[model samples]
Target chain A: MLADGLRRALTLLLRGDPEVLGIAALSIRVALVATLLACLIGVPIGFAIGTTRFRGRRTALTVLNTMLAFPTVLVGLLVWLLLARSGPLGGLGLLYTWWAIVLAEIVLAAPIAAALTAAAVQGIDPRVRRTALTLGAPAWRVHWVVAREVRFALLSAVVVSFGRVLAEVGAAMIVGGNIRHQTRTLTTAVALATSQGDFSLAIALGLVLLALALTVNVLLHMLQGRGDAGAA
Target chain B: MLALRDVTHEYLGRVVADIPALDLPAGTTTALVGPNGSGKSTVLRLLAAVEAPSRGVLELHGRAVRSSAERLHARRAVTLVEQHPLLFDMTVAANLTDALRLRGARRVDGRQISEALELVGAGSLAARPARALSGGEAQRVAIARALLLAPQVLLLDEPLSAADRAAREALGNVLAALRDRGTVVCLSSHVLEEAYRWSSRIFTLVDGRLEGMTPENLFRVDLPPGTGSREVRVGPLRFSIVTDRSGPAIIAVPPEDILVSRTPLDSSALNQFPGRLTAISEDGHGRIRLAVDVGVELITRITPASLSRLELQVGTGVVLSFKAVAVRVF
Candidate 1:
């Protein structure tokens, strides 16, 4: 049965089945948008929190670190309640739509980005900032020097966050509804297929998901290697 | 001139530097000579405007800087190379280019970057990555990065505290060039005689207090009106003076000027004292510092060879002699 499922999955992939390609494309697209939004909102927040000294910063970091380990299903359940009918945001009626799934993944990815970025910024040497200040750099330019010094680590944070959100199914399944040919992501389709005892399509979708995760990990290692070289 | 008036700074609620008045004039290479923890680096930071004074003013060209904008302007006019300088994560050439860009250079000239690196004998390391540099190479590159800005004042903290003989000679050439170029260089050093070779204006600091302008051996003397002899009593000894002012005065005998001998010699050179060597310590840079008491405490630095030749120890009684002309009154 496994061999037959694998052979059938490869054939479907090679034939470019519209259903399979559409699901894969939607998965990549939704996750890409979510990851970009997370980075846009989280990098600056993390940099500020990491560099500045203020009251309650320790509490903020503690909350952020806790959010990094929050269950994905819990994030999905919270989004479900917020988007459910008669909920606070129910007026928008975004439940079980592409936007709903994107929002869920965004909620999932942002904290990862923020927490890792803060760690990266904190790991750098303060002398780099002082040296730039002495070189006639204005405050903003000094900030740029610090960011540039840790650019590799920042990229690693982005990749790590992207990897986390891409592999997560609970949030997308709860918020996207797995609608046929519209919101059916690879993971949701695999779940739907496996429940009906269709192992071929489920295995095919699992293979695709595994390949993508492998790619993300490889990219992460490559980025870390370059960062170490630059810091050497 | 770059001036600091009533500028005092505190670190973590403890006073680290207190400068009543300091004037680092253009065309002068001033040296802040002191031992460890003497607040030399703190004074340099205040002069560079990188650290605001706890209660005082920093003046650029005789105008007091009052606001943040003016403080930034003051910082732009001066550049400081920290004692342990950190280079940006880039090639040597790129670091200089970034500094030029930081100073608002719209068009970064490659020739100018190369020239700055070459100025500090670091031209060969222009293409080398910053992380790959040795200690001396990194020091040279950091200084080169600062020199690229060509600010009116260049403050260096402990520039010679870590260099070897060859690096020292090369850095000496760089300092000599800056002196002739009239860039208003101010640096700190434990070795005073080396500072004298660069500039005459020296500010000595001891325990965070400005002890007039000498590396060591500063004495507050009372110059009472006397007969025809040009001499003043300090402690249990008398020293000849060149200045005619006859009131309380501060006198400094440069450490290099005093010659140590086993016994008093019959020579034309005038002032001499018999004293016991109280302490002996090494500055970790091939120089020995000695403290002696001839009814008053005095400090001097000499080489290892001289120490070995004189056979000096903690309790040895020796004679200290210097010409009357060597005593500086402030």
Candidate 2:
């Protein structure tokens, strides 16, 4: 079966299937939107967690930390329930749409961003905060300085979050329905190709996924190196 | 002026700081002296608004900071240079400009940055990354960051205490200049002599409670002959100036004022302690430092020849004597 699947994937790639290319492009577009949304929402939350010292801060921090390990299928299930027909957001008809896939991916990536950013901020000493405050930096300016200083970590967070969301199959397959020429993404495409015994197509998608993951990891490593150098 | 009216802070439900009505004068350097865990840092934090008072009220220029936002604004008027310089993970220029930016000073000139750096003798370090700085340089940068904001009050939580004498002296001069510029500088030091030299007023924290808010006054003790201060018995080795009045106090005695004798000798010096020798080490010069403990352990620097002539040992006994006149009760 594996040999037959490999032959099918090689032939599909040789044929240069437009449907496969479209699915790949749509996947990238959805993942980009989701990651961008996550960045917007998660950066500020991460900044708050990193810098604030309010009551229940620790509890809030712990919750975010715990959410970092949220399984993709569970996130997909939760989003499914929220956006499903007869669900709270059912009237939006977002299920199996690119928007629904994007929404699910955002949910998958946000906690990663928040958790990483929080750790980055917490790594900073209170003395720096005190220094910033005493320097007459208003609260907002204080947050900005902290965020800028921890930018490398934030970038690494974004990369890791993007990788996590892009590689998630359950959310995309469930929310996007792996629809052809519509909501299919890299992970869902690989799964569908594998199921259909289209091994060449699956192999090509697997390579892309591996490349995407590797690129994110390399970027993360570089950002981390810069962070260490800055700290040093 | 930063004033505290019975400011108290607790940690683990126990009182870490309990200052009773401290009125720190603006445009002068005051040193808070105490042993470890004595709430010295707590006092600075309160003035800086880093920590809220657990019970009593703290007023900056007669206004109470009621909320965190208010405190942030109040804190802007004051800068705290902590014991560990707390350098930001950014360029020196960025760290210096951070406060100005926070104040919304977008057009802050390079001249001002250079001026602040020069004030701290850190002009060359403007481009240096904060994390790459040595301990002393980082402290200077911290000071520069504080001063660039031109804060009304400067709280240094033993900023230079951990540094070498050269660094401490440089920092002291910078602080002295800040105080001269009408900035209220509050410095904490565990070393009394260093604190005495820099602070116009000296306050000592006793057992988590602040005491001795007296202006430094020079007092002389006259010792009788053959009564070397070294021979006098003391309960503890703690150098405590027993004073009658309070506002700020100072003790001044040259090393020459200390008269050491192997045997009990009569002298004009009134204070004497029977010190057990712990370590006899030589100061670079002709001076020798005898680590002695009578009631409290102390290090007394005497002449090298005197050390040898007396045959001082790690376990030997000696009489530590200093004239009452020599012991200036601040």
Candidate 3:
């Protein structure tokens, strides 16, 4: 039975099944949007925290680092409450929409982006900051120079956050409602297909998801290797 | 002039640097000579506006540099090159040009970049990746980057630490050129001879305190009570200084007045010691400074020809003679 399902899965994937394509496309779109938003909101905050010294900075950093390991289901529960009917944001009616899934993913991905970015920024040699400042670079320019110097690490943060958002299931299922053809992502579809005893569809979606992750990671690795070589 | 008034900097409630007063005049090179942990780099950073003193004020041209605006303005004119300068992850030319571009230079000509690099003897490294360059090469590029700005006050911390002998000499000449161009150049070095040779004035720091400023051999000696002349003993060696001051006093002997001979000299000079040559080093200007130890180490400068004429080597026996009048007691 497993062999038969595997065979049927490959055939469906090769035949360009519309439902499978739509789920995969939605997964990519949602993950990309969440990752982009996370980066936009996280990079600057991380950079500031990484470079500056102030009262409460240690506590702030500790909090951010702890957020990197936060459970996605908790994030989904929190976000779900915020957007659910009769919840504070019930007026928007976005509970079962793609935006709700993106929001949940963002809540899940932003901390990873922030924490990794902070680590990358802090990993830069302190001499780089001193040299730039001594050369009359203003504070903002110093940060910019440091960011460029650690671009490889920053790129890794983005890739890692994207992968996290793409692979996440609990948050998307809870907030997105897994509405077929509208908000169903690869991970949610695989879950629904398996529970419904549709082994062929489940196997097909799982293989496509794995392939997408492998391809993205491989491309990022190649880029990072090139960057390292160029730096060397 | 860059002046520090009642400056003290602390880190985590521990005092790191404290200078009651200091005046670094324009158009002169001053060397901050001390050992590690002596707060030399802290002084340079404070002067460069890379950091602010925990107390008191640092002023430039009679204006208090307290505000960020003032510090930013001063930073444009005063740049500090670190002990281990970090080159941006780019071509050496780009590193130099980036500094120029950051300083708001609209048109960065390649010739200007080349000229700056050539001045620091890093011309060949223009096309090379800065991160791939050797330590000495990176230091030279850093100096070139600083020089491109034509800053008014240039502070360097151990600029020659990573340089080879030839590069050290080249950098020394570049510093002289910078001083001649009326830039107030200050550098920190643990090499006393190099500091004495390169600086018009030298500030010695011991345990984060400014000890002295005379360009001479300084010795903390105790003097017995005397009226006109006092016998000062440093280690096992004794020297007479013509001073009315008694008790603990610092004595300085000008290197030029200290004469080295192969044999004991029968002369009117009041001080003489039979010592051995401990080390021979150049003063970056073709002159040699010989480290001789009788009971205490005394440095005497001579020409390279004289060094060879005397057949001096490490551990060679020599006699050092100096007159009491040449000793300045403070």
Better of 1 and 2 by DockQ: 1
- What TM-score goes with each of the models? 0.78, 0.76, 0.81
Residue B218 of model 2, lDDT score:
26
Q: Taking the tens digit of each residue's C-alpha lDDT, what string does model 2 give over B240-286?
A: 33334333333444445566777767866566777688888776676
Candidate 2 residue lDDT tens string, A20-116: 6676678778878899999899878987877777999899888887787788788889999999998999999999999999998898788888888
What is candidate 1's lDDT per residue for B71-187, written digit by digit as tens? 778888899988888887778898888888886788998998888878778878888888788777788888888777888899988887667665577678778778777889998
Task: Provide the global lDDT of candidate 1 against the true structure.
Answer: 0.84
Model 3, span A43-86: residue lDDT tens = 88888888888899899899898888888889889889999888
lDDT of 2 at B236: 34
lDDT of 3 by residue, B58-107 (tens): 99997899988788888888988888888887899999999987766789
Top-down TM-score ranking = 3, 1, 2
Local accuracy by lDDT, each model:
0.84, 0.76, 0.86
List residue ranges in candidate 2 displaced over 4 A. A1-17, A46-71, B212-330
Q: Candidate 2, overall lDDT?
A: 0.76
Cα shift from native, residue A9, model 3 (Å): 1.8
